[model samples]
Target: MLRRKQHRFQHNREAHNVIERGKELYTTIKGHWQEYFKNDNPLVLELACGKGEYTVGLAENRPDVNLIGVDIKGDRIARGSKRCIEKGLTNAAFLRTSIQYMDEFFEEGSVDEIWLIHPDPQPRDKEEKRRLTNPHFLTEYKKYLKPGGLFILKTDSPFLYEYTLEKLKEFDGYEILDHTNDLYQSPLLKDHFGIETHYEKLWVDKGYTINYIKCRVQ
Candidate 1:
């Protein structure tokens, strides 16, 4: 398994859809996504995108938008990169980097939307600062997200759902567009809700409610 993982990482390095750390493109691609994607389509990012289920799904469903999946794990990114290549998804790409360094890759106000799908809850009180919706990370996201851009979060952890809500309230310039503790039962369900990540499926099968939030950054 270890060998296969290494092989996938290597394959991702060679794949056109992937930009791994230490590569020249990793740094040069910053603020030049239009050139990389060869289009001026609105850009969307999926952070901590393990396996990139949503990234691939969105690209397949929304051809008018360009999608990039960001994650630190190259082996995991390989799966989504391969799928995009197989399907000839030119508008989809993968970036292997930690979410903390997002600003380094994207220009200020360049992103149309940011998605956090089933992110780590960081349930421990001491780890609250590490949550994706924490004020710290939200500040980072604000750097790249365009004014009035969307920030969406979908998670199975009640702790994360409530924590994110509180953070959004405390943070200025964020308007909550919609939220639901149980998405499947909510009237706010949209077409995109049909795309389920691997983790989402697992939690749903176990009778866990899926929490969703859609907010716009000012």
Candidate 2:
């Protein structure tokens, strides 16, 4: 029993490494994270990356970019990171942390591009602060996105999409390239969903409209 407990304890530690690293990895990598990877790859971030579905898919398709999946849930992080490891992908990384503390991890104008896929809309009035497209979070993203870095947001919520569109007009650091109700009808929707994760495929099956946008951060 003691040996079993010890093994379980070790297991939990490995599972929580993303969370632990999320808290402290940035301070050490402030100006030198790229050195550790030893290559000139574009830094791509998937914010609120549940299960890292998109991150893993993107890394699989594009070997030229370094993909980082960020989420706050341990279970999701474990599943996502484990999948990446199973695929033997060196270009992908996962971090467990809240969006509120993102500035700590990314230096100003460091990220080359960003992806926000299926982020919780938090429709409740009180939870409006939790919306990933809230002006505050946009500001945080702007700080990390390099000049002209691409910011892509894909969701099923029309409310969130319309809200984001209105805000982008007033926001300082973005140029909205495409805003659409159905991604399939648009010629720009290149099957970016690699493994389909779980939700993206489900949404497609249910006939939910998938909205997408590609914004260039100014």
Candidate 3:
């Protein structure tokens, strides 16, 4: 496992679709991705994009938009980046970086939409600050999202679903577009909600209900 990880890290650095940390350009500007992808398409991000199923899948369907999969795991990034190349997906890229430093790579108001698909819920009360849908993370996201940008959260954790719903209520500049504790049972059968991650499928097979929330950051 260790050897495979090391090899993947090295291989990812050479993949055009993969961007690793310590890249000088990443430290400087946020909108550099436009130049990288060589287009003016709206940017969409899949946070904690393990193996980039959402990023690659969305890019395949939405060629009009550019997609970036952000995750810290180089091994998973290698798989996603490799698939992007094999499929000739120019609009899809993988960024091997922690979500905590997203602001450093994106310009203010640059992002058009964000998909937090099956992110770590940080279920413990003491880890509330680490929850991706919590205030701290939401504040960071708001800084880079354009006005009226959408945030889509999909999870199997009931705690996170309820917690995020309450947080949205207290947040001043955002409004809940829609939410459902049982995604499969909801009327939404397509688009972002229809796109499933590996973890999502596993949860579904285990008889866990998937919860989803869509909010517009004003």
Candidate 4:
């Protein structure tokens, strides 16, 4: 309970990088990102960004782009926001909100890239629609991602990897750019692959083969 209060305090106190619930900015920041970042850089989003590992990593790697981490957990978002503030990173920000309301926060064709890092597989047959790569989510992505924008998924679940592949195949105008059932063994591994999220490290330590897919929506 004390830790929750601390997180809430920190999350509310930090306005430079955190955009939490109950703020006017939460509803008004849709197309006014340039005013926030003070630049016209490409926009990238990390959905369900628990602790914002990818958001901070990508912001550090690509200063030319603006990255926003979106998640509903304020405590988790607080951690990432604190890290960004400590690192003095202006390109990284956190939005405390549910991923289902993504369209309300971003304009159509405004996102240049999106990363889904180790999202929950929602493995049960009845939970298929809740998977991040479900057709519904793909359509939501399509609504904001620019033409030829990249949609990258990194996961430790074979079920999700295969499910995403099947959905992408069925989805219109989604072109697969690269994929690997085992990311570390594949040549598709890039420099940014070195940044591992907390959950990713746990999965790797358990000898899970990380699956990765990169696609473009046309």
Residue 96 deviation, candidate 4, in Å?
0.7
Could you give me the TM-score of model 3 versus the true structure? Answer: 0.94
Top of the candidates by TM-score: 1
* Total backbone collisions for each predicted model: 0, 0, 0, 0
Off by over 4 Å in 3: 22-24
Clashing pairs in 4: none
Error of 4 at 8 (Å): 4.1
Of the candidates numbered 2 and 3, which has the greater lDDT value? 3
Against the reference, the lDDT scores of all candidates come to 0.91, 0.77, 0.86, 0.88
Model 1: weakest 10-residue lDDT segment is 185-194
TM-scores for all candidates?
A: 0.97, 0.88, 0.94, 0.95
RMSD per candidate (Å) reads 1.1, 3.6, 1.5, 1.4
Kindly list the per-residue Cα lDDT of model 4 for residues 1-218, writing each as its tens digit: 98786866576566668886677888899899988899999999999998898899999989999999998887787778888888999999999888998877899999999999999999999998899999989999998999989999999999999999999999998999999999988887683548898877887888888999999999
Task: Give per-residue CA lDDT, model 3, range 33-126, as digits (tens).
Answer: 8888888999999999999988988998899999999999889979888888889999999888899988778888999999998888899899
Q: Sorted by TM-score, highest first, which candidate order results?
A: 1, 4, 3, 2
**What TM-score does structure 2 among the candidates reach?**
0.88
Off by over 4 Å in 1: 191-193
Write the residue-wise lDDT of candidate 1 on 144-204 in tens digits: 8999999999989999999999989999988999999999888866747489987688888
Candidate 4 accuracy as lDDT: 0.88
